[model samples]
Target: MNLQDSAIVQQFQQHCSLTEEEKVLLLELEQNPLKVNAGDIIWQENSKVDQFCTISQGWAYSFRNLGDGSRQILKVYLPGDIIGMRDFAFSNRLAGVAMIEEGIVSHFSHEHLLKIFRHSTALTAGLFAIACRQQAVLTERLIYLARRTAQQRLAHFLYEMYLRLGRIGAADEGRFRLPLSQEQLGDILGLSAVHVSRTFTAFREDGLVLRDRHRVTLPDPEALAQLAEFDGGYLNDAVPALFFDREWQSHMLAGPTARSDEQMPGKSKAASAD
Candidate 1:
């Protein structure tokens, strides 16, 4: 089977159709897979941030080691996830990324992204939409950590994972593999190992979640969402329809790009108050 036209591109641009040349730009990011084992560090914190990567096989995550000798996991990388995006603008990595399972990573230079941005406005829009959606996820994470109970946090995290996996067909009907351990969960959830274990057990007993080792099955995802007070709306993108010129359908025309207002934010305020 060919690697081009893979699900990774489809996930990134669910709302727009890519021209043939645009598809090539997207596929360029998926080239050159390097096999890595579990616990492998793709890149360390403070390393030079000049690349973008895609997980073509398994799972990975970005995390930070706290000064107090603990870890704080920032995001779980699924198969179709574009890693290194969080640091696209930075000269050095703010956090370290590592593998959660043996997987293949397609690593490409940050310049490849520049090519996409210069070549395809539709792709740029898709990428921005994804970034905004991810920002929403991070915002929800904040709310859960600050206001939710331990059980609520656990349920919300698991259900969120279920929905994410379902998008890539790795999960279905609430059945999915969570390749993470209790200790890892603790890092992601801002809880101690024992607290995560206790909360996991409590939710299990309450029939909010069921697990067989690493495999989790949500017997009633609706009920689980209810218990967590979770909102799945953030996962969906609301990008507006993008249009391309008939003469330049495959890519954006080459020229000086539009400049942002120097006054920017304040200028928008000058335009409208309602």
Candidate 2:
């Protein structure tokens, strides 16, 4: 697939305006691809984090291997995702990454990324926006795992995947290719393999899903979304700028000393709703 047309590139454009030069930089970053096989461990946890890679083809996932020989799947990757950014501030990998299926990846050095960060503010902000979206997904996962019911969790996950895959036109009319196994789904949702199977049966009987091998087609996406209690608002793709002014400058100068309590970022954001 062309790097210019990849999901990450399109997503970056959604978050910020990109110059043709910046677009070329993105293309250059994904050059010199290496082919990988399904089940290949791309990198082990605790490995040096001096480099990151973009998924040029196929699918992959990051996971933590628990002491009991089980796994907790952290993030699923589709084509165009640049891996290793989560560990950019660290010297070692935070989680192990593996190929879910045969794919290709292009490795780039941290030094090169730093150069891009310095040279392109637009791209840098775009990257930051993308990272925030990833963080939001993890935060939502934490919430659902702690509070949502099994069916709710499963519903939410499927719906989320549908939306994400839809970005690249991989999903339409509620149908999409799910490259994950029942065991992998269990790991992601903290369920047993049997539980995943049973839940799939329940979903089918309830008219929530229609499965044909690895492809799932939601019969009634709206109804399924209601059952999932899914708030897709967070998935909205935009990174509008906050135009600071003299009042904001005064707040920066005085809020720290005069009214420190108002200086919280979340508080400022909420105040902007006015």
Candidate 3:
């Protein structure tokens, strides 16, 4: 696969209209690619963090081990995701990343990324928008684990994956290949493997999804979305036009000081209405 034509770049292009010159500059920043096999650790918690990578193909996940020795999956990384961007402000990796399937990732030094930031306003804005979307996904996962029922969490998770994969042109007719095991799903959704299996059975019995090993088919996306109480607003693809406004740009440059309080899943206005 062409690294330049990867889904991550396509997604970035959607948010920022890059000039030919800018595209060349961005391409130069990426070094040789690395091949990761299934179960390989891409980065480990507390490791030195000097570079970020873009997933050119396959899937991976970021997770952390709790004090009790159980793992909490932070987020699932689909093809085209920028891994390690979430920990840009930190000196070391805050979480561990591991490949779920054979994949390719291209690394870009943090120094080179900073150089790009200094020279390109549009690219910087695009990167910021991508970071915000990553944060949104994490927020949604927090909500899923804390307040949503097992069924709701599973439904919402699958629906989100479907939309994400669709954005990358990886899914068709609501069908996609997800290589995660039941144990991994349990880590992500805070359930036991047995519970995850039972939930999958429930979803299948309800006619929401059809499962064939690693392949999943959502027969009725609309019905599934309703069941999950999913709102796609959190997955907005375009950056706000107002971000280009001078005053707004200045405000963003000043940086955010405080983060929003964690949101309860069913407490949001949209969720309450459902």
Candidate 2 lDDT over residue span 17-42, tens digit each: 67778787887777778999999999
TM-score: the better of candidates 2 and 3: 2
Clashes of each: 0, 0, 0
Question: Against the true structure, what is each candidate's TM-score?
Answer: 0.87, 0.86, 0.85
User: For candidate 1, lDDT tens digit of each residue in 1-274?
Assistant: 2444475677665645567787777788877889999999999999998787988888999999999999999999888778889899899999999999999899999888888888777788678877877789999999999999988888999989998888888898889999999999999999999998898788788887888889999989989899899887788644444422232332223323625423232233422322
Residue range with the least summed lDDT across 10 consecutive positions in model 2? 242-251
- Using lDDT, give the best candidate's number: 2
RMSD of each: 5.0, 5.4, 8.2
**Local distance difference test scores for all models:** 0.81, 0.82, 0.80
Tens digit of per-residue lDDT, candidate 3, span 1-274: 4546856667678666665666766666445678989999998999999888888778999999999978989889887778888778899999999999998888888787898798777778888888888888888888877888998989999999999888888899999988889999999999888999999999899898889999999999889889888877789644665333334433444544534543332223322222
Worst 10 residues of 3 by lDDT: 265-274
Candidate 1 Cα errors over 4 Å, as ranges: 1-5, 243-274
**Sort by TM-score, best first: what order?**
1, 2, 3
The C-alpha stretches of model 2 lying farther than 4 A from their native spots are 1-3, 241-274
Worst 10 residues of 1 by lDDT: 243-252
